[model samples]
Target: MYALLPVSPLYAGLALVPLALLLFTLVVLRWRAHEAASVGMFAAAAVALAAYGLSPEALSVASGKGVWDAVFVLYVIVPALVFYHVIERADGFEALRTRITAFTENELFLVLAFGWVFVSFMQSISGFGTPIVVVAPLLLALGVKPVYSVAIPLVGHAWANTFGTLGVAWLALVQVVEMQSVAATALALGVLLWIPNLVGGLSIAWLYGRWEAVRYAFPMVAVVSLIHGGGQLAAVTVIPPEFANFFAASVGLLALAPLAAWSRYATPTDAIERRPVMAESIAATDADGSSPTAVADGGTATAADAADPADDGLMSLPMAALPFVALAAAAFVTAVVTPLSDALGSIQVGLSFPEIATSFGVVTEATAPYSPFSPLTHPGTFLLLSALVAFVVYRRKGHYEAATARADEPREAFSRTVLATAIPASIAVVSFLVMAKVMDHSGQVLVLAESAANVATPATYGFFSPLIGSLGAFMTSSNTASNILFGGLQQQTAAQLGGLSEPLILAGQSAGGAIGNAISPGNVILGTTAAGIVGREGDVLRVTIPWVALVGALVGLVIVALNAAGLLGVA
Candidate 1:
């Protein structure tokens, strides 16, 4: 048995008080995550200082660690988002949307194909709110109801979140559990989360339409759910955990082929009229041969009735999609073409700063700073390329005059990308950092994890572990942070419960973190903002809370069944 950290019972009790306050502040007082997090962190820090004694040096160490955590998010999300915005500003996204919609007008197919498959792909590539920001606007453009647009994507691809983007959250989980491979961990979690994920998908589909939509898509949804959930489990168990989301999303997309065929032949009971792409004003103006809708919107003409081909020009779908094609190709080369990816990744910057000797203990320092113009393997690099390509395409094919006029204007292009990508991305990053730092430094997180874990009997921690995992994610607003904060605690509790396998325990931790995204304050805010439903966070929460609880409960049951069946590999 490992030696446990020693502390007075009173101090331990006091250590947990911050957690109680965190719950009250978030659940009762209804504070934003940032507010609750700060309170929790300050309280935890104070308790640690009082019980463990103050350490001036620990401050530097903690701060350094916090910065490192922030950098990790910046490296991946910032570039990815910038990349997306660049393409968006170039108007390439519209072409891609047109091509996708041309395939089928079935709303159910569109939601599943784009909302689930495409969004999952985005999540696998760039996961910080990229899915909703990118997909929601596209859905809105596709004439999907704004409310359904906001909610469907938010819930549909959630399960893949933990292992997306090189399995950042899963990596964090394993790091906390001190496990090397996340295969077993992901498998265990995947098996447990399968039902909840299925239910979530069905629920989202239902919200998209109604009982008819659910009935129509049940078979297809099942196929998607199995492919997604099963593929994810298999990837973690057999393939690299880092590739789990990428692989699962790819497989799920493939499963859609048969489903699409089936839908085409299944009978035309609900063949709703094809939703028009443009709004009434734009469509009416285009039909009247007035200023081309694009020209009117682009400010190329002052007269409302002037028909200007130069500003109103629209490109063939392929022309606009060049940038995305390039992006996908580049991303694939970087991720799958081993030599290219390695060569680019090899040009990294790594440095170790002198450890600060302080009252807290010696803390190691490390940083990997890169030039702003990193290679295409960087998500930012691909995004930038896509943007530039998209801009060129937009100019050459659509608005020749406008293109020539803006050819030399780089700042305008930059502004376009920044407005679309940075606003939401920055907010998400700030929100995540604030929540993580507070949760980590505060004793509230530990107390909360312990409190949740304590709800189950020692023997039942496996069955109940996901709830504790949910609590950690809720507090931290990040699966990665939750894993960092509670992975060890969950594993230790499971160990004491009955030598439960580390993989199963860690899987529960990752699974809980994934589901928590639905209830996560940062995500809720982003979803609401994307849907232009700002200030309705409370309403969104009211809808999401029950789903979160249900998912957690279902996961708990799976954990229990697996453990009882001796299939969980409990030690």
Candidate 2:
């Protein structure tokens, strides 16, 4: 039987309906991610059932897969929320701010340190929009203008999206594409991201102090990008992709303090002529949590001379930093150490379903277990353990003052965390995954790939591959979901091209998806909401789109060069 008006251009065109609706509600209607995604999911289901001839049982199984996928997503998100709350309540963020500021008083280096290095580091540990939530406020507290505060982190963290949040995006890419050369794909992705890391550092500097400031901070930018990119390349070669961002960003953060201390990139001795006064940069926030903006006259404040406010007689550096340190260490050991990986991985848990076939003759294979989530080894576990360890340490250090301890109260913290994240996040996860499942099981994605393969030449396709991945994320607002939606398509299209490198194509896709995050409305809104600019989403997107497009194009060029060299499919 024909499915969805036959496997032709017509059916492929039908496949786009769900995606179009998703983009419409999300971008034009300005709907929340969950709401738009839910609407899209239903639209996808209808297409699958009526046009594609999906059996009810198969559809049910697909929905089950989505919920199972949601479980994997929520495991990381819920724990990350708790972990962030734990740190915020204990004034760990303030401690971090004080330590970084003490390292360098220069505005340029400080922006690079927090906006580039630290933002990437946070993305590694707590992704899915967590980095912006944490780093944007840190920038604001450091006296950065609201627009710069929000925009800088969005740009700074773009390079880390695929490997960040403990490789959630990487996992999704591999799982959907079902590739054998995962290590090769990881290496290619790490190499491809070199441009973004380097460009992002320079971009941050320029955004802060313009072209002159970029020149001043140029050395730091080069060094930071090398450390970050090199670390990721080395880590992916040795370990799993999940640890790539954490390992690399850590190397970058460690290297940054020394570079700032020695280089004197923006020190008063070198650049008194062009320094932007630190105080004049911080936008005064309104009490109603409206958009905090820069002063019309660019006035200065006395607070610039003071270090970020610290808790009196409490919250020392080690006490505050130890929890995060533990978080990295735990996630690393559980994932990298073979014995621990096997031991923890053995306790696999998830749902299982029998195979079902649609009337269109598309068959989903039976699986004993699906979307398996390991309790001990998962990032969620690491985050929880880190939170508990930090909590005990903070209590021991007397960090729980009644006035400063809003996040310290367990009931309030948990309640607030759930109330804040549960609805929007959970809805987004389930609906998006269901949408992906319906499209995938209905053979819509395969037909789309076949169509692309028919029209694209190997060389030109390489030039546009990353752009394809970017489109997926722009619609879905998740690099992981982007991978799930298009990873198989990329692989199939690469296979059809004969000499084209599948890994390289995958790399470009991953890189494109990462960069796409900068312009993703869902994420931009997250940053805006955090920075108290809930209505100026257009302002954030206007700046981010140009950066993302330029970087994505650079990645596409790299992919084409690799294709010409015959290195793409060398394996």
Candidate 3:
């Protein structure tokens, strides 16, 4: 093996330039995601070539890998948008929205339901930003402002990033890092992630109406957090990690009924109804006799013209929920059924890349199959199946056929919506992923991690460990990728630090990566695209960043305290 390049302050600082520039462009300049990601991609390429001595061929391989990865993400995006449009054309959302309002008109409780509980449920089953893409618009349909609509789910589902999606992120961490105690790591992560789970629920309330909303929603948030976080912890100890999040989130979803039945939340409170985060009431109509719905650019759309229920007949709530039910069933079978999951996962697709090395000797090993994708088990497959099921069922029910002359044909509308939303989103995802690959291949990510590790003492290393993982997630916009990039580093650093519990530190790393999804540019773009607020990514970030930081810092302190108290190790 060639000796790796020595880390230095100058090299580390140079390594950080792309990410710094990305943040500046995104948050300060308020550039659209595609624009900002493209700029960052070029910056990373420059830094990789000039400072890290990355070979052009290696760069090509990395970029190609990034493109391939983007395809995986796009698979979900395209089908999800198709599924969304299919539902929209069937007037399923209005039916669902009506059902939700009928269940409880308390705005705070409504926000928590779609934003926290339902989004968490989505993440548990299909979490490649699926929760945000699916739930944000539902919130908007309930008359929430577009920005908060996107932001709410962004924060709400972040805590599930590590263990959700059938524990893909957790499995990735295990694959990359050799751990002394897998069970301990799982338990620690279960405990640590609870903070964000709790914080995310409360944050949604706070975002809706500030302190008053929090006070109003506190009991419900507590109950949901217990089911979501505590239930996950309890489940993980006895059940397999893959089933933990799904069970917990499913229970949370079930609990919502009773929670909504509680006297306080069952009736509309005038105080809670006056939501600061929602747009004008859904009943508000423009002079043209159309109901105004908030659009992403702070504009209103005449959605009511199409969405208003007519005498012909609206889809029943069960029919409206059919697609998601199908989606959940498909995901459950593929993820939880052992024989079916194995058989479906047997046919995998991946590309092989030759071992590549930078001039400085950082090496990426050659593999027969890199990042293999099992198409049948993928979230995209589930989404597409759901879309197809929705079309057939809705058509049979005469929902789509009943559309007015003004409405486009269902198939044509679905195709148009998918193309419009997926194309720009694909570009942004590719740009962001390629930038992440370049940074990783160039040893820039390593330098950043090592620089942080080197700067911290054992006393302070716990605090910095999760931050490194957060940095990785911010760059990659994936907890799985973040763990793959930094799991070993976190493990090695913990060993080197001495007295730090490896499991605790790794748990912190996982927890930090989980929460970081809230502010990841790729994730933000997914939310914005789904909510029809594509360019206002900066606004969503502005809302989510503080929550992420707050949750991340709390995770760090928990790590520190656990380490100090000698509770980090497995008994």
Best by lDDT: 3
TM-score to native of every candidate shown: 0.73, 0.78, 0.93
Candidates 1 and 2, the one with greater lDDT: 2
Q: Tell me how candidate 2 scores on lDDT.
A: 0.73
What's the best-to-worst order under lDDT?
Answer: 3, 2, 1
lDDT of 1 at 329: 66
lDDT, residue 569, candidate 1: 69
- Residues 1-571, model 2: lDDT tens digits: 2233255778778888888887677667767667777888999899889888788888898888877766665666566656766776666766666655566667677777888898898888766576775566567656665556678899999899999878989999888887758877888898998888888988887776677888878888888887888788888888877988888998888887578668565353345334342435333333444323333322111233453333454466677678767976785566557897898789988778888777667778888787577777766777789989988878776775632644343445555645465456656767877787777777666565556556678777877788878876765567887888788778877786777888999888888889988876556656654554544455566568788889988998888898899874643
- Cα lDDT, all candidates: 0.60, 0.73, 0.83
- Candidate 1 lDDT (Cα, whole model)? 0.60
- Decide which is better by lDDT, 1 or 3: 3
lDDT of 1 by residue, 1-571 (tens): 1122223355457756666665567567766444565566566556655653435455444444544444544554454455545454554444455555455555567666766777777777655555665666566545454445555676766787787765788777766666634555667776865665687778766665556667767877888888888877777677777887888887887776677667562333354322222222344446666522432222111112223223233445777556656766666667677787777877654334333322223222333331222334566566667766766666555544443444455445555544554455444445445444433443434544565565668557866677767777765557776787678887777766665677777787778888887776656655545544433444456556777888788777777777777785666
Q: How accurate locally is residue 436 in candidate 3, as Cα lDDT from 0 to 100? A: 91
Q: What range of 10 consecutive residues in model 3 has the weakest lDDT sum?
A: 299-308
Cα error of candidate 2 at position 491, Å: 4.5
